[model samples]
Target: MTAVSIEKKVNGTPVASPELGEGRDHPDEEQHTPQPTPAAPSRREEKRLDKSTDRADARLDKAQEREEARRDADHKRETKEKERQAKADRKAQQRADKDKARAKRRKERRTAWTSLQTRLTHHMPMWGLPVVLVSLAVGATGQAGAASAAGMGWASAGVPVLTEGMTLTLAGLTGQAIEQRRPYAWLMRATWITAAGAATINALGHYIEGKAGDPQEALYRAAMYGVASMLGLVLWWVVMRSKRAAISGKTADEVARWKRLGRRHPLLMRRARRVADNTGKSMADAYATVWERANGARPGEPSIREIRASRRAAYRRRLAQSWDGRRGLRKQSERAAAVVPVPQADTVGTPESAGSAGVRTPVQAPALPVALLVPGGQGGWVEHPVPVLPMATPKRVRTGSDQSATARFPQGKDAVSKRVRKSVHDDRLNTVRALVESEAARGCDLRKHPSNRAVARAAGCRPGTARELLATVLAERGITR
Candidate 1:
């Protein structure tokens, strides 16, 4: 542990704890004396008995001396602890009492800042207040976030602590700008970019609404949220990008990563990009944490896609049964409809029905011969029949054993669904059976592989289910032979 300096006001001057050693006054002495013996009657005693008694007394004295030493040490420790606690309490009280005054002073300074800021509003026409607030908020927020991260664990804290130092430096520079004639534009931009980026990410989450369903709706919502959230971010970034491009003589969007390394300069776009990237990484971690919570997994655990796939396959099988039977019913309907005779045009009507010359009246039109009817009809009459295109009728087909369809095809090609796609992506199982067969041939033990990685390679099978299926297949084929 690092030596922590605790300031002490021993007299009228402040002294670090190391100087005082937080000294504890020694404990009061405790005496343990041997039991006093009465003068032997007439001073006469056996030599052996007297010697034994003397030895026993010596042992007692040794034990008492050791006990006294231990007691003294414990007492000193306790007293020091008490004094340390007392001093800490006094300091805490002082800080609490002084907090109001500190806050008052801070507020006065902030108000003076406001007045100065108002006077420079037009003078600082190029930038805006949101940028300044966002910068301060980001700097403060980064400081706070880094502090929080530092407390999580050593493995997690190292990089974050480093980043915290970097952010504090940036914030210090930015804070100094509140008094600078011309503030470092990059530092100012860094804060604004950070805030805007945060807003964008938050909006992105709201937009996605989870992958529960309605991809289009989710995408639309995400886009709308992103656009709305980035309105301010976009404006700020554009302004910053423009200024950066002007200074570096590079394009607005481009910034060399090397320039961001240990950056002490203020107007560097690379610095903002670095901080924004760090924020993104943290955001991604938070998102991953949330994902794990929803899925009942720890961080970096594989998604239980096989279990989901099994459930989906079951559901699709059920739907197939419900829907496959409907095809026959549809076929029957089509056959029955094919036999119904189409009505002729003479029995229908003509547009000339309203004429009284050689053109027949509406009452006489129906009596005209079918051939003489001009094979035509009025607007409301039924139109001529159109030839129906032939449909490939569905035959009764079995979904077959293996419950997974890839088994039936000799080439071992993947079974494509006319319905939904599988949960695992295609790259994992580029050649579904080749993966399974080759692994089986090698006598490879999947237990040796990472569960999720192995399962993904097994044609998106659940790790457990895939193991079972492989055993079954091997047994059926006598691979053990």
Candidate 2:
């Protein structure tokens, strides 16, 4: 044991000392040291850890669900897009098909039109050559026969050649003139004259032969000879006419129309030609001008559409005007009530008393009961005292003093027949007027001098009636003719 001094200080000043002992004699003393222990987790921390785990799991599940929903949406979107694309493809294919069909149809129509035009315009060589050959042979034979009968013998054959050659040359000249669009009237006349002379010669020869034999046989032979001699000329003339029409740029329809117009309106054609000569205009233009001047309308005026529209308007107006009356009549007939008139005896004045005293005594007859016919439950009409509605008055009324009720109402089948006749007359008059207007619009020179025959033929009316209607229409339109 050892002692040691211990001191205590307050502030910096030493105050007291104590003895301390050191023990070194114990050899087996144990040394002990303190160590810290870890503290356990709290319930809130464990709860928070569990909540974080749950939140992580929930977030993962939500992410998986979102991905699945997105995938589904994408799949649905792709399907919809594919369907739309397929629909578009189908539409495109259908459109292509329709276009192909339309194109094919158009091609077919064009092909048919081309074929038709070719058939119409290319017939000269097919029939013309055969006809020409036959006609030439016949003409030559006829001419030779005529010459032989005239006692020329072999010289007659040479004469036939000369005549046929001259005719052919003239015919060729006429064709050339037609092709050149030149005036071939003189050439045509020459050809006709030559052909006629040849025909006459052939007929004369036949006549001479027949005079030596049977007269009937001579007539038949002469006729045959004349017909054979003119066959070639006729064929050539037709070809040349067709060629002329082609050169004039006139279609068959136009030629036919012009021919029809000429036949129907010779006066118009003459007037048009005169106008053409005076105005120095083309015949067509001059014709139009003349037609306009005469008809008071341009060519093709009052078109079918216009006429139809006018007719429809007239019909509509008439219909509107008659609708109410017709409807009322129909309704009244459907619910008709029969009316029985009550007869009352009339008061009579004695003639002698009136002459003697200038006064008349009136006598009244017995009144009769009025009955109305009504439908019974058994579908039969029964008379009753029930009041019935009176018949409706006519739409038109006459206020003249001379017109009686009977006259105003116009009863009986005769009245109906008269009405029907008047209606028919009006319809016929309208028809005539339409025909006249249509003719005028179609370029007929109706104002100056209308063709009554043409009008009568078109209207199916008497010529006198047509003339009267024409005059009436012309007068109504302030025209002189």
Candidate 3:
């Protein structure tokens, strides 16, 4: 059995210890023991616990408020920074757009300035207005001075308006007449007369005013006043002329050409006028028709056929007169002839044979002389002749056809052989043949071929030569028109 012992009690309750045998069924202890009830907590301790809980809650709320404020400040700062950046971008974009527009306008202005017509006529009014105003002011002053000198004291101011006004009114009428395409010669003459009279009056007035000071100064003042009074008239006349030209659809060059033509040929202009009235045609058409009839083909111009004929005649004359007014064929006969194979049917006839057969043949021209005209001892011209050596003739090849002919030429360093001549002829013929083929391909009738001028241009020869070549080619191809 364990021993039991009694222990000291707290709060008036006794405790039993097992080692002291106090917890055993103690026959020595009281059988009926009273248990002690638990006591309630004290008021002071409860109050202390409530105070500590309130302090913790208050600290948590303050920390939450501080966190919320810090977050709001950060959000505001971020928003402001974004807004600033957006504003900067917007401003930069605006500047870029403005700069682009400005550059476009500048480029447009530069392009507009590149044309000569624009340069001459654009902004003419802007420049002319200032000149007109200045001229009016100076003319008025000169007229007033002149009128006062002429014993019209207060009436002098009205005199300038009458004189200058007449000129201006006449000029306006002239402009109106020009716009209507009516005859404005009388208006122009009247305007000029009025302007001259006004200028004279202004000059006289200025001279009278300045004569009291110095005679030379008075003359200078008179000239200055006169010119100033006429300055506006001159500018107005120029404007009127420009407007007239524009309305008439005549360019400056066309006006200059007409003026030159009129100056050179007054009778022609009168004849053109009569033709215009009789034929009911425009002056230009009448002039052109009359000119073509008086001259030939184009106005004041010769036909291509005539030009080529003249050139060929001149060339032949020069060739004939090359050696002291002779045929100049002796030099050509001295050189050896090269061998050139030519078909019998294609053989060109001699001049005498051509006259009988009505076939034209090309005559061989002589060479130029190897002589230089040097200054003579007595100041007269003397010929210094140079010696020329003969060349070896090429061997001729005989064809099977008895009618076939071979032209021979010399083979040397300086000789222009018959082979070269034939080749040049062949080139010209080939050019004409190609032109014919092209025309035929384009559906043109071979009977009616192109003009001689076109063939001449294509073959790089004169019209006469081209005409002959074309005829030869046509005859070979059995085409006749």
* Best of the candidates, TM-score: 3
Alpha-carbon RMSD to native, per candidate: 37.2, 33.3, 21.4
Error of 3 at 314 (Å): 4.5
Give the per-residue lDDT of model 2 (tens digit) for 1-481: 6555566654445534422222223435443332333455688988999999999999999999999999999999999999999999999999999999999999999999888766433434455667777877888898898888788977987977888899988877777787776778899999999989888888888898889779999999899878987887787778777887888898999878888988988888988887666535577976775564454335776423354468579766654433321234455444332323345445487334445566565644322144446789879999764333334443455456424333212332234334544544565577567766777788877675457875565444579978887787777778765
Q: Write the per-residue lDDT of candidate 1 for residues 177-210, one digit (tens) a residue.
A: 5434344768876765554554444344544444
**Model 2, position 474: C-alpha lDDT score:** 77
TM-score of each: 0.20, 0.34, 0.39
- Candidates ranked, most accurate by TM-score first: 3, 2, 1
Higher lDDT: candidate 1 or 2? 2
- Clash count for candidate 3 is 17
**Top candidate, metric lDDT:** 3
Question: What is each predicted model's overall lDDT from 0 to 1?
Answer: 0.48, 0.69, 0.72
lDDT of 3: 0.72
lDDT of 2: 0.69
**lDDT (tens digit, per residue) of candidate 3 on 1-481:** 7544558766566666444545557657655553665775588977988989899999999999999999999999999999999999999999999999999999888887666435334323557878987998899888988998899989988988998899877887787788788989899999999889999999988888888899999999899989998998899888887887898898999988888998998888888887677646688977875565343344545543455478578766554443332333555443324212222245567333544656665644333244557899878989764332333243355445533333222122112233344655786698688889889889987777687887876655578898899999888889766
Q: Looking at model 1, report the run of 10 residues with the lowest lDDT sum.
A: 364-373
